[model samples]
Target: MTPSDDDRTHGGLETVTGAGCDGRDACCRLAAGVDRRRFVQGLAAGAGLLAWRAPRATVAGPFAADDAIDHFVPADKKLAADWVAGLFARGERTWYAGDDLATIGMPVGGVAAGQVYLTGDGRLVYWDVFNSNHNTGYGAVNYQAGRKPTDVVSEGTFTAATAVDQGAAIQVTVHGRTVARTLDGRGFARVRFCGEYPVGRVEYADDALPVAVALEAYSPFIPLCAADSSLPATVLKYTLKNGGDAAAQVTIGAWLQNAVLNDAGPELAGQAERRNRVVQEDRFTAVVGSARPLETAQEKRREPIVIADFEGDGYGQWRVEGEAFGDGPVEGTLEHQQAVSGYQGRRLVNSFQGGDDPQGKLVSPEFVIERPWIGFLIGGGGFADKTCVNLVIDGKPVRTATGKNAELLEVRNWDVAELAGKRARIEIVDAQSGPWGHVNVDQIELRDDPKTDAAIPLRRRRDFGTMAVAVLGGDASAAASIPDGDALEELFAALRGEPVASAEKPLGENLRGAVGRTIELQPGAEATVTFVVAWHMPHNYRENRWVGNYYGKRLASAVDVAAYVAKNFDRLDAETYAWLETYYDS
Candidate 1:
């Protein structure tokens, strides 16, 4: 397996991995809300190398490769949009058009009509969380005839706000790829009938990412619509005024119901499932580096286990609920590059979710808002920062999650389908200043799902009668190398209430109070040195690097990688090979 950008090598065999586009590294160290970043001048220099730039792959447009939609509607007229084709609303619209449409338009009534989408059914349309103007409603009267568009974007025809009272329509259009609405003297002209579709106009800037849609009143850059709004209903009920020669084979799944927006919903439970899918690689390439394999790796060289594929535009939002611990500016992140402590010099551009308005936008799918909090600590160190997470959905933040001193906490709110067209920026900025600095984010998630509830972090377990053993390694041979013979004997003897061997040897820096030392097999060495290894999911996976690989490799004073593992006895057990699917060459 190739070392994907997200790949974070632990010892030798296991590498951390996760979803998201830019970096695939499974961020375990850089906890949620807060991420640690170091300046990597060398990386910046290499990235600047024009010669090193690999040839970018040119993909054929949807039209050239596989044309699916067959029904044709004229382009030069109002388009009859298929059902459930909604705009992330804030006076917004975004039509995914290839170079196929010649023109596109939609008949909008007034500011109220310009909603997230024309809700065919009106059941007090709601947003579970991650407030973005979503859920088109039919109950709200679309146009008041002559009124300005509430969330007006772009100054095109239908360009200005329509007049009030004279009864006119708002014009929607797609000129080339630019989106423009109509505005005239007699209020704007609009069409409102039983059921018609609006033609989608598409454009791309920032690369080939689509920009505007016809029926959409605003861009996906729609603001977070407070689900608890006091304003008049802005129900977007669009009828297909006209359909030129355009084809649409859109599919509207079961009508949007008030999905399970609680903490224990499906999306959250399935969070770890994604890690199961991401097959990571140990780039045996970069010699023992300063940063821990990009923070952490859950499954090493793993292949995807789930089969069903899913996609969407802005539904992939994440929210984590846990308490933040530690005093004095404890750092965090969603997913981050795991660099050693203070290994600064080269700065990797990191996008932080902390700090207010770093001049950033609430991505189409989710609205990002984080508040700093305070919490009590255990066993001393200092006070811990706490946070309650809420994402904007349908223009409102849904769930409230809190966390404590946890790095790279997991958020499972995103379903497989919600991950479509989603992107995230993970950067470590200066934490001294305001929100613009590097704020720690314990967990980052694609928030809008019913399952975000159960995806909480693992709490320490106290009850223990027996222990299991397992190994974490790409190959069984390497895992077999751990000295477990003597350790195993001692553990069994103790369980039977007997004095066992291998109980009083010295512990390595990474080893801590783990089982004890193993007898050596000198030249005439015929000793079975039994050692016990524990295979915790992501945490134990992190330990593999310290004990198995980094024992004598990394600098001292670093994360006594092994000792950290020994500290969490409950989270440890005999090492076990991850029964993950195999990864084939991409």
Candidate 2:
């Protein structure tokens, strides 16, 4: 009789002579039904020392199904063979499509890159693979009432009904109607998912659409092939068969998010340093996502000319309004405020006089711009134009910048080369009256060159490595879309057959966005579209220590990993299929 699905067994043998197990005692235990002397002699004659077989149903224990209490069964309880076989003959288990059980999908990423799950309905979800936390649950921490930790440790799960439109997705346009292969919105009527470790298949069927689509997602897992098995990539192969009679224009699109530095923090909301660009190297075409550090120059030039030192005992030439700024430039930090730094001298503008309830604006005497750059130290709330320093020229603010919710001031430089010799004024406005509704300023200067030691914010760091998604063996045109609100909604517009105006220039930067690739097929034809997702997060953090990943030693970036997978797709695909065939035959 053939072995059932749960009847597979694995065994191995190793030398255990040093563990106080001489050949005599082990042989006697194995030779219970045979002669002890013959068994010991056979061991010396190069016979197998250890062997194991699948457990027989005669020795199986009882199966329990109770919800209120524990279902633990004793080891000595015996069940009949027919009863055990009947459990296997019931049917194959499957996870249905819904928002409640959406997190129970199959993992499709590499070993240490974290988890990226492909749900049963073909939508990619649960993207916790990035270094920052995403979906890992939370636990209680014991702490004093006023000493609670304020740092974010987790981002919680994304399995709600509203999150169904988030992450990567596939859309197929048949004739003029578009159908997202997910269980959300106007989804397919029937969906089936079957997952064997390292290989998963999702089949989609609907009466409204005239095509049948099946997706096979996996990472290479060939036995004894450690190098090929440990790749930091997942291959998504889509097979589509058109069942329509007449010729039909079928458009298939795959979209992915620029999830690098995901969950970093809320401070990175509108930074332009987050980028997604399309690249073509050799035969591989991919869209790489990364967070780049803000550019800085290290050159030394002329010394800065002081604009406003704010060192006098009172407001001499600068005019102050409202109750925010006191009668004069106050000293250091105010009452009920954090210790402030990075300012020169003993006097500076401190707007938190009474509290955050005060609002005011300080206007500087109009001065002709002689230098090419205007530099200043600023700190306070990040309310954009509400709590910021402005460079006003011709009665209009030409440049504006705000603090990053910080107490320590950082140098901010503005390139005012175009405004040189133009009459300009400095405005320190604190028109907000809410939490952190104050502003701080000091040591304003006009310089020939920009400041080189301006501290780069944490959200703009280049710590996050690159991640890429490539369409293997195809020169399909790709586009990157920056979202005004929802990233998936912007991506779906392209999948719904909308013309992308930026398709020719596939390079753009945004905090959150999507990249898409499109291709068309005729009716009654069969086609396979393959996509590979790869990442190169080299650094690993644990126990307050930083280390390097082994995969990073060979692959420098995600584009490199994708290119390697594209070059070896034939060999790796063949070996993976071969292993699966051998296992099913056994």
Candidate 3:
């Protein structure tokens, strides 16, 4: 049989392929967060073949083809976002901004970070850190409201007090007077919430050191409440320059604390199951999740597997929960690029109105897992940094399926042969707290065959198990021994004018909190340390199948970036690093 058509084209280093449809197709859907006008201007500026003085509207030519834009911009070059949505709490009203968080209004009522969605009534729906509504991957959730820690901290040679708010503390001084962070020292510079959902940028700068130092943070914003939205995520971009005659060592530090899945502090042994551990040094991706307790259900015997389908005005034997909706059972599809075909007849969907805080679940009736295949079509989009179709066996999520850029009807079939003779159920989930936090599902079928003819080949599903970080010059032992709890404190303290002491106590999981690496920057010289955060999620079909694919390709994408950086660390300049950091669409 021919290889299944996954509706994708493979192009490695020479020509990168984005998560969207084949780039060659003019009909391919545009990415959710790209600006066409800005793209055109960039092209003209780069080529220098077009006149820049002419107005954009009047200057149309060969490159104006709608499909032409996709050819020029690769997926890796797209404006990446991590947050689903953000707001500046000002006065009595909460003003909405695009991914950039470029809110011009004055913020009030203080900032509290967490996954939040603004409703039609102007009220905000929030799930504080530890709340499992539909988002994952962030621990310190107070950043959304521009909240800062309540302690004094030092970054490099700069010592500053934390803001008593949710957003980051950004203080910029030009000349002699303070120019930015004018709003009560909140350090909020911009909050743009539109276009490719760059999320928003929060900035803090100071002239305390011989060199001017600035910190700009851009959070990812998933469009339309996508579960794929990066939670508690802020890509902190730093800028430092030396103007003094003597060279100096510069240090930078930030506080990142995980509340242990909000399971009531870090002392509990139960925190073990819910523990968040950084998997690697240099490059790292923390595995933060709570596992479901084990439970068993008697296996029902069945010869030829009975099929379950949703057709006409019926949801079949499925029980729906959360915010799922369908007319006359589950029917029809909404406009997303083009008309999405319903599975066979009817389809179930959430966020029909494209509302925010879109979250819900669809559970199927019990059935014997006598076959090696479970097939279905899933389509939907959000900031969806983590949206997924979770296959819950017995009671735990045994497997997960995910798509990108609002992909329509991504066909998938899991190898469930090991579960044969076992009883199971499927949980189609769409728990997104941001905009477009919805899911689309159709044509779910159980088959004895593995659907080898499907678009995505089964054999290509193995994990690479490859992610590593490279540290330059540093005391490896000292760097490794830092404890997570006191790591940030110690680093900040060192920068805050205290002597850098070696921890007398041995290192432990608390090491996750410690900065993975610390390097001394000599006067007029800057140092950068890079590492990979990699975790290979055990295939869901295994016995311990509680891990979800919410991060899906998110962590893997980081792995890819980390790998690139590791290989090209010496060659990568600040300009290239900045481009790659923002280029990532995760």
The top-ranked prediction according to TM-score is 2
Candidate 1's clash total is 151
Instruction: Report, for every candidate in turn, its global Cα lDDT versus the true structure.
Output: 0.21, 0.62, 0.36
Kindly list the per-residue Cα lDDT of model 2 for residues 222-264, writing each as its tens digit. Answer: 8887777777788888887777764444445555556565433
| lDDT minimum window of 10 residues, candidate 2 | 2-11
Q: What is the lDDT of residue 35 in candidate 1?
A: 9
Model 3 spans with C-alpha error above 4 angstroms:
1-36, 39-204, 214-239, 258-490, 493-512, 516-525, 529-586
Task: Write down the TM-score of every candidate.
Answer: 0.17, 0.52, 0.30
RMSD of 2: 14.7
Tens-digit lDDT track for model 3 on 82-115?
Answer: 2111111111111223321321211111112223
Give candidate 2 misplaced runs (Cα > 4 Å). 1-95, 98-101, 133-186, 263-272, 281-283, 296-463, 481-525, 577-586
lDDT (tens digit, per residue) of candidate 1 on 1-586: 1112233221111223575323845422211111011112213544332222111221122232124344343223322232112111111111212211111223321122122222211111111121112222332333323323332222111222211111001212223332222211111122111222221121112211111112212111112422111111121112122222322211100111111112222222322211100111231000010101111234432332221111222113322211121111232222332321211122211223333223222122322322111111111110112123333345444333332122233332323243244332222112122222222222233222222222223221111011111111221111101123333222322222432211111111111111111111122212111111111111112221312112213213112222222232122221100111111000
